[model samples]
Every structure is written in C-alpha cells, then in structure tokens.
Target: MAERILIVDDAAFMRMMVKDILTKNGYEIAGEAENGQQAVDMYQEQKPDLVTLDITMPEKDGIQALKEIKGKDPEANIIMCSAMGQQAMVVDAIQAGAKDFIVKPFQADRVIEAIQKALS
Candidate 1:
C-alpha cells in the first residue's frame, strides 16, 4: 500500500509541488496544511505514514510543529524542508527529530529519495 503523507507548508505552491512529486511516484497524500498548527491537527486526523514540514512558515514554524508532533508520536516520520541553505537550521532540525532534509526548488528525485528513506 502507498504510504499516506501529510504535506505542511505556508505556501500553496510549495505544497502543490511536493504533492505532485509524491503522488506521481505512487505515495498516498493524506492531507495538506498551511501552517504548523494545521499540520499538527491534520497529523492527528490522518496519522500519515510520513510528513514533509517547511522550516519557515507564518503562524508556527516547522521546528515547533515537529516538536509537537514528535511529542505526541515519537515515531512520526518527518522530513524538513527549507529554502535557505543554513547548516545551523538543518542541524537544529535533525536534532529536533527530523528524519531527513530537502532543499527548496525541490528535485523530484531527491524528494522521492528522502521520503522513501524516511519511511524505510
């Protein structure tokens, strides 16, 4: 069965780009969220196999949302996304429990690889 995935991003375009990649590769899209809070809420509802969270967002950032989700379900598979290529933020995200990281202007291959690796 395709793994259900929750996509969280403040930008609709980013979310659409990711959804297109994952669905085309046969992964199931559980839902989409526009902010960290929504991501947490949808997480409870969908209990997706994985989630791709944006590190920077309005309302709540990915780090906060990742913490909340991880707090609720330590096993949640989450991949962090960011447009800025900052090593500090990436390290912080990894320390906070992100299974993987994907840079913005995402390459379909990298996105697929990250998701697949995270699920594994």
Candidate 2:
C-alpha cells in the first residue's frame, strides 16, 4: 500500500508543491496542515504513516509539534523541513526525535529519499 503522508506547512504553495510531488510518485496524502498546531491535531486524527513538517510556522513550530507527536506516539515517523541556514533547528529536530530533515525548495527525489530512509 502507498504510504500515508501528512504535510505541514504554513504556506499554501509549499503544501501544494509537496502534495503534487508525493501524489505523482504514488504516495497517498493523508492530510495537509497550515500550522504545527493543526499538524499535531491531524496526526492524532489520521495517524498517517509519515509526516513532512515545516520548521517555522504560526501557533507552533515544527520542533514543538514533533515533540508533541513523539510524546503521543513514540514510534511516530517525521521528516522535518526547513529553509537553508537553519542548521541549528535541524540539529534540534533530530535531537527531538525527528527521523530526518529536508531543506526547502524541495527536490522531489530528496523528499522521497528522506521519507524512504525514515521508514526504513
């Protein structure tokens, strides 16, 4: 079965871009979130196989949401997304239990590779 994925990004364009890439590659989009708060809520409701989370967002940032999700499901699989130059945030995300991190202006292959690696 195709992996179910939740995409969390404040920007509508970014979410659309990710959804387009994953859907074209046969991954199922479980849902989309405009902020980290929504991401956490959707996570509980959908329990998708994976999550693509943006590092910066209103209400809650990716790192905080990641922690919340991990707290709820210790085995949750999450791939954090950040723009270039957010190395510190990336490190924190990894330390906080995110399975992987992807930089923005996302390359479809890289995104897929990260998700596959995280799942493995």
Candidate 3:
C-alpha cells in the first residue's frame, strides 16, 4: 500500500500543493489540517505513516505540535515545512525530533525527497 501522509498547513493553497504532489507521486493523503492543533488531532486519529507540518500557523505552531506529537509517538515520522529564512525555527523543529524539513513554494522533487528520506 502507498504510505499515508497527513499534511498540515495554514494556507489552503500550500496544503493543495502538497496534496497534489503526494497524490501524483503515488502516496496516499490521510488527511489535511489548516493549523497545528488540527494537525495534532488528526495525527492521533489517523496515525498516518508520515506528516508534513508547516512551521507557522494559528492555534498552534508546527514546533509546538511536533513536540506534542513526538511526546505521544516517539516514532512519528514528521517533516517540518517552512518558508525561506526561518532557519531558527527549522533548527528547533529538527531538535524537537522532526526527521527532515522542506521549504515553501514547494519543490516537488525536494518535497518527495524529504518525505522519502523521512519514511525510509
């Protein structure tokens, strides 16, 4: 079966972009969340094989959600997504146990590469 991935991003367009890439690449999208809180909630419910979590969001940021999810599932495969120049936040995300990260204005190859690396 294709790996199931949960995509979390504040921007609908961002989520759509990721969804498009994943679907075309033969990955299954478990769900989509508009913010970190929803990401956490959906994560618990879906137990997807991987997650692409956006760093900046309303309700809860990706770092906070990443920590929470890691706390619950130490093995949760998570990849942080951030815009360019958010190096500090990305560092925090890596420290918090995110397997990898991808930058926005999504590059299909990089995004796929990160997800593949994390899942592997």
Clashes of 2: 0
Q: Tell me the deviation in Å of residue 109 in model 1.
A: 0.3
lDDT of 3 by residue, 21-52 (tens): 99999999999999999999999999999999
Q: Tell me each candidate's RMSD, in Å, in order.
A: 0.8, 0.6, 0.4
How badly does each model clash, as a count of residue pairs? 0, 0, 0
lDDT of 1 at 62: 93
Candidate 2, overall lDDT? Answer: 0.96
Error of 1 at 94 (Å): 0.3
In model 3, what is the error at residue 78, expressed in angstroms?
0.4
* Model 3 spans > 4 angstroms off: none
The C-alpha lDDT values of all candidates are 0.94, 0.96, 0.97
Model 1 weakest lDDT span, ten residues long: 82-91
